[model samples]
Target: MNTDRKPALRLENIVKTFPGVRALDDVSFEVFPGEVHALMGENGAGKSTLMKVLGGIHQPDEGRIFVEEAEAVMTTPLHAKARGVMFIHQELSLAEELSVAENVYLGELPRKSLGRVDWATLYANTDEILKRLKVGFTARTRVGDLSIANQQMVEIARALTVDAKVVIFDEPTASLTDAEKVVLFEVIAGLQAEGVGIVYISHRMEEIFKITDRISVLRDGEYRGTLVTSETNEDEITQMMIGRSLDLSRRTARGEVGKTALRVEGLSCGSLFQDISFDVRQGEVVGFYGLVGAGRTEIAETLFGLRTPSAGKIFLKDEELRIHSPIEAIRHGISLVPESRKEQGLVLGMNCRDNITLPQVSDLVAGPFVSDGAEVAIFDQYRDRLEIKTPSWRSAVGNLSGGNQQKIVIGKWLAMRPDVLIVDEPTRGIDVGSKSEIHNLLRDLAGRGYAVIVISSEMPEVLHVSDRIVAMYQGRVMRIFDAEEVTEDSLIQAISGIENGKVA
Candidate 1:
């Protein structure tokens, strides 16, 4: 809005290269003071790389970075923060055992006489920031005790601790509830009012359109173009980010519905979820839809033997089974691609081949040691089958993009040849192009007669990929609807614990 003002932060012709890849290539971007500039791209489009350059995590091979119209060299993260650049990363960098005050002023805590921490000053300052943000928790509260949303508030409060001219939010709302997101938007608005520039990175188009003033796109490490949010549309932005318009239509019914492959009757995991009942037939994809903390992931965990059901009956092919561990679940022909791939699904330090074959490593072993040939064969099979884009089988899973990493997780589970496959938030942080691919892959899996259960917070994803959707609210099933008959309004109402305008 302030066209005459100098940019709060600017990157000119930035180029960053890694082994076998140019992560960023001649990409230029600028964020004006008080502007919410959205950096849009598919998963591997170099947005993260560019942000790293700005955060001084990785130095750019070539480019100039200007802060407030002056060229500055950000040699380290400390230097970047000293230069008024702050990053609120997706995976929070807070020490859980520390209090909110301590986490906020982590590295630069105020000191009193004799090098002791000035506790009173720290708590007072943090309380003021918390009050300004209108957050519920106090500065004295331990960060580990707070919800994910409140923890993020601590991160935002940390940004305000310094004279931050620019704040970078990387997928800030990925784990937030709807009410939490509203509060976050309010905080962002307040920051804008204070003339602080924001660089927002997210895959959710709706959030981008709603909150951003300007949108700059990147495609395959190259700068595409920038557009004023008010003047552009999602289709145009999608084209700019992916080089093609996406098919936003729902998936048609694929594969004949057969006998029930998995059936859960009266499933209960204490207060996490209650009396949950569902059945996934052979060659069908059943989507579980809800907001965060609605027990979607908990239900998946329960099904995968990560949690014991207080009261429930699990049946595979109409045969009752007691599964007490993940290995037991796998032995019963059930595989779970967990919500957090980095934490639960794959070993980041391990190569792609090892990650894929890990679940079935025992079976792949020879007389004494593990067989590399067996592992590579399984990896190659799934790599080609899943179309994972890795440099090689030897490439570490951590080096791949979000979409590819997700595919590898799926590959890991798929190698077990499970009768029932549950993928939780299958395309959470992936870009539009990869999202489409994952959606299709789920359907294709169903077509191949592997019963699929998709647990998603994304409404469109559930509607697009599911044959039948189970909407949950506060750990209870609100309603079940055939995808063909489900309306957005109805689904929203169901997830909100309302049916036909009354509380469900």
Candidate 2:
């Protein structure tokens, strides 16, 4: 593990602060050559702030950064990259319209006489990197046409373009499938073999244990102790991050199932999905489980009137309806919590109160003027109900943590008092504690007679909260099993399009 070598990158006594918040406080961290160090923390634990300090995005109030035994002042992102520090962020920054090679060599494209781009050299260099990564796509392939997993490979290729001594990966596998994760692990291993240090940040414990050598924890901007990966366990790490051990057990309390609240018949959305039929009863949680691109999100969008179905029948309380828009869906007593909270769910520039009352702004008007009293009342109701941790109702939604931002989205939808609620990827980037809270919140909502449909890619989440599970594969329902009757192996097989070792 190169224990005798000097650290590839090191930060000492780092402190960063905003106007009203101290994001980082006296934090110290180091990554050795050829080692994978995991930065563990719950959302808003100062992990992002610390990374920003390292990336030169935000200058630390007090700190020192050293690269290979020499002090380095990273004044900008380009300076950080020049010092052999590269970051592959969670949300990729690649130019989607450009080719893989162009995206890889974005700023530093090879130039010929008179500043004309040297396309031949650029493609040749990018092809060598792609071949080394063993990816299937070519250098000339358009990045927008590639899958999410392959696009991530392009991000990694960009890192390799420089003489990177350290690479930071922030939740790289959040959108990848099980098979794709294996490929990512192989790539990380190859980097480790070449003596490149890696700083891995993710909330998934399984991946941390499988890929990391050391785990350093943070809580509320303070540095916790670091533990060797082999010597520490998930329980210990959970305690370090959140100050308490988590309950990793499944949901045991079941809500009483009543009459069907929502039913879909022969729902077809072109090539997205075909002949999909499912029903969610009152006071019950129905989980939809599938791999990425398995048409789960597409079905939810169809039901929410974001997309028009080619052919289908939607019934709410046994009455057929044709929903043409999101407003129509909301009027029909159906609400959707979209997958990407930043993109479709919340208005980042708006305050918490405004975001929560946005859908019902017209109703909130007293007489030709929106009532601030009504907006604050609704925001306060859901803020306490959802346990959203914000400084105030006037705080910008974008300043909150990922978990809190997600709760605001849910609270916004909950204000509508819909008969049926659809939540997609409820805990995609949330920490362990917040994930448990959100899971329990879904169950509590169901017990309160709100029909819930949870669409998740994580198998444990689907199994933990669902009363009945619908497994889909390649745009078709493979099977539906009662929570008590489903086995992990059987569920995996169903989602993989295999039943009893044969294609379903």
After TM-score superposition, the amount by which residue 217's alpha carbon in candidate 2 deviates from its true location, in angstroms, is 0.5
Give the Å error, residue 122, model 2.
1.5
List, residue by residue over 318-376, the lDDT tens digit for candidate 1.
99999999989999999999988888888999999999988788887798999999999
**Residue 413's lDDT in candidate 2:** 92
Collision pairs in model 1: none
- Looking at model 1, report the run of 10 residues with the lowest lDDT sum: 246-255
> What shift in Å separates residue 100 of candidate 1 from its native position after superposition?
1.8
Query: Which one wins on TM-score?
Result: 1
Candidate 2, 246-350: lDDT as tens digits:
777765456698899999999999999999998999999999999887899999999999999999899999999999999999999999999889888999999
Candidate 2 — which residues are off by over 4 angstroms? 142-148
What is candidate 1's TM-score against the reference? Answer: 0.97
